[model samples]
Target: MAAPTADSASPADSTDPTNPADPTRPVLDCRGVWKTFGKGRDRTPVLRGIDLAVHEHEVVVLIGASGSGKSTLLRCVNLLERVDDGTIHLDGDDITDPRVNADAVRQRIGIVFQAFNLFPHLTVLDNITLAPRRVHRRARAEAEQAALDLLDRVGLAGKAREYPDRLSGGQQQRAAIVRALVNSPRLMLFDEVTSALDPELVGEVLALVSDLKGDGMTMVIATHEMGFARRVADRVCFLDRGVILEQGRPEQVLDNPAEPRTRQFLQRLLDTEPA
Candidate 1:
C-alpha cells in the first residue's frame, strides 16, 4: 500500500504565504515526512508523510494508541530516526539535509523519553550539568550554578547533591527534565515521559511540564494522559495508521472529534479506565 499523501497546510499559517522564510517562523516544521523500518517486502512504514508545524511557545501534543506512529513521528523530528522522504526544518534550517551536522542540530533540541536514563552514581547536579559543561564548553562553576537554579525551580534544590537512586521516581523524572532544559534548547520533545511513573508520582512530573508551558516553552509531547493533554496542549493531533487523522484545539479534538477512527480510539482508551 502507498503511504499517506503529504498535506503542507500548517495550522499556524494555512493562510499566509508571503514570507515563507520569516525568521520568526515555527520552531519545528516537518514537511512530507516518511519513515519505515525493516527491509524490502518486510518493510513497514511508521510515519507515512507527516507534515506539522509547531509555533514558538505553543504546546502541541500527539495522541494515538500503541504502534500508531506517535513515537516514530517524534523520533523522526528529533533525528533519532532518519526519514525515508521529506524535509524537516528546524527554525528555518533544513535539518534533514544529509550535509547537516546531526550532532549540531540535536544540541538545539531537547528530548526526554519514558525512561529517566539518569546516571546512577552521578549527583542530580552532575547529571544536569554534564552536557552543558562537556559539550557546550561551559565552565564547571557556571554549569553547576545553572543546574542548581533549575533544580530549585522544580522544588528539588535540597536533593541536588543526591544521586538519582536516592530521589523518588517523580524527582528523578523532574531532574531528567531539568537536565534537558539546562541546554537551553529551542524546542523540546517528550515521548510518554510519565508512562513509567507510579500513578501518584505522575502528577509531580506533569506539574514541572505545566511550569515549562507557563514559561512559554515550545514543546511537542506524546502522552496517554488525556486529562493532562486536554489541560496543557494548545493543540492536539490524533494519529491513525501512520497518519495524522485530525488536529485542532484540545477541546475540539478530544471532545467533538470529527474522525470516526479518532473517536473510536479515544472511546476505547477511556473505556479501559474507570473515568
Candidate 2:
C-alpha cells in the first residue's frame, strides 16, 4: 500500500473535535527546555526552548529531519537524557527537578526506541516481566501473568517462550511494545519505532499503536512516517534545528503549513516517497 499523499484527509479528521483535552492541566508539559552535548566550545545544542504540552489521551507527533531534536525531546521527557536547562512536568509534577527521583518518574512513562532493545538471553516473557517484577516489586506470578496477557493481546502469546532472535522484526517490536505496556504507564513515548522494520513489517507495529490510541493512551511519538502521524496524532509539531517551527492539527500542519520551513520539509518527505 502506498503512503497517503500530503493533501489526503487523515482518518483522525472526523474525530478531532470529539477528543478535546484540557489545556489547563496537561499530562506532559515541557517549558523552555534545552539540551546541549559536550563542554564549552564543543557544545552543540540539540533542543532549544521546547515548549510543548500533551494532554491526557492525546497523541502528539514530532516530525522533522534527522537532527532536528525530535528524539532528544522524547529522551528528555523520559529522563533518559537530563536536560541542560528548563523544566519538564508530567501530570504537573516537575520531573526535571534535581530533587525528583528519576527512576520513580520513569515508572509513570514507557518509551520504545528504534531498536527492539530486548535482552537477547531473556525469553520474551522474561524480557517483558523484568521491569514489573524487579523495579515495581510485583510478584513473579502477577508479572508473568500480566506479560502473557499482553503478549496474547499483541498476537505474540506463542512467542512468549521464544528469544528475541527467534522472532521476526515485527514480533520483536510488538514484544517491546508489550513490555512497555506491562508497566501500565500513564504516558508512552515512541521514537522512530518502525524505522528499522522491513517495509511490509511496519503496518503491524503501526496497527498496534493505532489500537493504543483507541484505548486512549497518552503518547508522544517522534517519527518520519507522515501518513502514520496524520492518522494517529492529535497534534503534529515540526522541529527545525532544535526548535519547533510549526505545530497544529495534522491536516493544518501537514496540508497547509504556515511556515516556509514546514513546507520545505514536507516537500522533501513527499519527494522521497514513491510516486
Candidate 3:
C-alpha cells in the first residue's frame, strides 16, 4: 500500500480528485470539524475544530487526557457522532452530506469500542455473522465461513460457540475486533479499546492490535497506551482542549515532544508503573 498524498480542498467540494491518483487516498479525512452537545442555549462544544487525515494501511494513534475530544473525533469519522461544522470524507467521498447513505458508509468503516458491544445472547460466531448476513444480504453459510476465518485470524477460532460472558475481557475484545474485521472494512476505528480490559489482559489485546498493524491494516486508535502508540503508530497526534496540540512521527511526538502539553502528558503517563 502507498502513502496518501496531501490534499488541499475546501470543505464544500464533494469530490477529491487527488485521491484516485494517489492510490493511498486517506481512508478517513476530517477537516475543521466540530461537535457540540447539550440543547439550545447551553450547548458545549466537544470538538472545536479537528483536522485529521488517515491514509490507507497506516496506523494513526490519538492521545489525549479525558475530555480532549479524542473519542469524539473518532466517532465523527464514522458519523456515529455528527459534526456541527466542517466536512468528513471517507475514501474521498463526502459523508457529511445529508444525502449520503450513512449505513453504507458505516459498513466500509468498522469501529471497536472500549466496552465490547457483543450481544450476550449470541454465540461468538453468531455475533460476528449477524451483521454481514443482515446488512450485506450474505447467505448464512457464507457469512458463517467468513466469520470463522476472521475468528481464526484473531486467534479465537476455538471459542466460536462461546458466549461473551464465558470469555475473559481480553478474549472478548479480540472477538469484537474479529467481528469488525469480518466486514473487510477499508478503515478501522478503535476508541480506547483497551481501557476496559483488566491489567493482566491488556497485553493480549495489544498483541492482537500489533499483529494487525504488521498486516498493514488501516487504523485510527484513541488510546493512552504510549508504548503501543510508540511502537505501532506511523504517526501520533496529541489532542487537547478539543484541538490537536501537536502531531508528528511517534519518535518525534512521543519521545522528543515539542509542545509543553504533550511533554506534560507523557510525563504523567510515564509516572505510572507498567501494567
Candidate 4:
C-alpha cells in the first residue's frame, strides 16, 4: 500500500471526530497533534495535526499503511514521545503539559505492542505484578491475587508460574496484555498487537480484545487486521499522511469509503490477501 502524501488533504479538511460523543468526557482526546523526527535537512514529519477523540468504552481503530504514523500516534498518547505541536488530553487532563506527571498518566493508560516484551527471566506472574507492586506500591499478596485473577480471565492462570520462554507466542502476548490490564488502566492502546503471532494464534488474542470491548474498556487500536477492526471498532478512522482522511462506523469507512485514498488503501489490503 502507498503511504499517504501531504498533498491528499489537510487536517482542516477532515471530518469532525466528535460524532459519537456521550454524556461522559472522552477517555482520550488528541487535538492538532504533530510529531517530527530528526533536525535541519534530515527532518521527517511523522504526525501532522492529528485530531482524534476516543470516548468512554469506545473502540477506535486506526488503519493506514506502514509509517503512516499509527504507532507514533499511540506512542505520543502514551507520553513516550512528546508532541511538537498540539495537545493530548486523557480524561480531560492535558497530559501533554510539561507540568503533568507522565508516570502517573501512564498508570491510567495501558499500551500493548506487537512484541510480547516480557522479561525472559521473570515468570508470567512476576511479569504481570512487577509494575503494580513497585510503582503503585501494592502489597505482594494483593498484586499476586490480582495478577492471578487476570491471568485466569485471559486463560493463562496455569502459566503464571512458568517463565516467558516456556509459553507459546500467543500465550506470551496474552501475558503481556494481562500485565497491561493488571494496572486497571482507564484506557487501552493496542498497536498492531497480533502482528507477531501465527495465524492460528491470532484469534485468541483478538478474542481477548473483543472481550475487553464487551467489558467496556475504552481503546484505540492500530491494526492491519481489517476484519478484526470491522468487528471491534465503534468507529474506524482512516489515517492518511498524519491526518484522518475519513472516519465513521466500521461499515461506512471499510466497506463504503467516501475518499478515493481510503478506497485505494482498502483495495490494496484486499488485493494482498490470499485465496
- Mark the 10 consecutive residues where model 2 has the least summed lDDT: 1-10
Instruction: Give the 10-residue window scoring lowest on summed lDDT in candidate 4.
Output: 1-10
Q: lDDT of each structure?
A: 0.87, 0.87, 0.85, 0.88
User: Could you tell me how far off, in angstroms, the CA of residue 151 lies in candidate 2 after the best superposition?
Assistant: 0.7
lDDT tens digits, residues 1-275, model 3? 11222323222234362466765466777777889999999999988877777777889899999999988888888888878998888877889998989999999988999999999999999999988999999999999999988788778989999989999999999999999988889998999999998889999899999898888899999998888899999888899988878888899889898889989988988887565
Candidate 2 lDDT, tens digit per residue, 186-229? 99999999999999999999999999999999999999999999
* Sort order, lDDT high to low: 4, 2, 1, 3
Off by over 4 Å in 1: 1-24
Give the RMSD in angstroms, all C-alphas superposed, for model 3.
4.1
lDDT of 2: 0.87
* Cα shift from native, residue 268, model 4 (Å): 0.7
Q: Which is superior by lDDT, 2 or 3?
A: 2
**What total of clashing residue pairs does each candidate reach?**
0, 0, 0, 0
**Residue pairs with backbone atoms closer than 3 Å in model 1 (clashes):** none
What C-alpha lDDT, on a 0 to 100 scale, does residue 172 get in candidate 2? 96
Please give the distance, in angstroms, between residue 134's alpha carbon in candidate 1 and its true position after superposition.
0.6
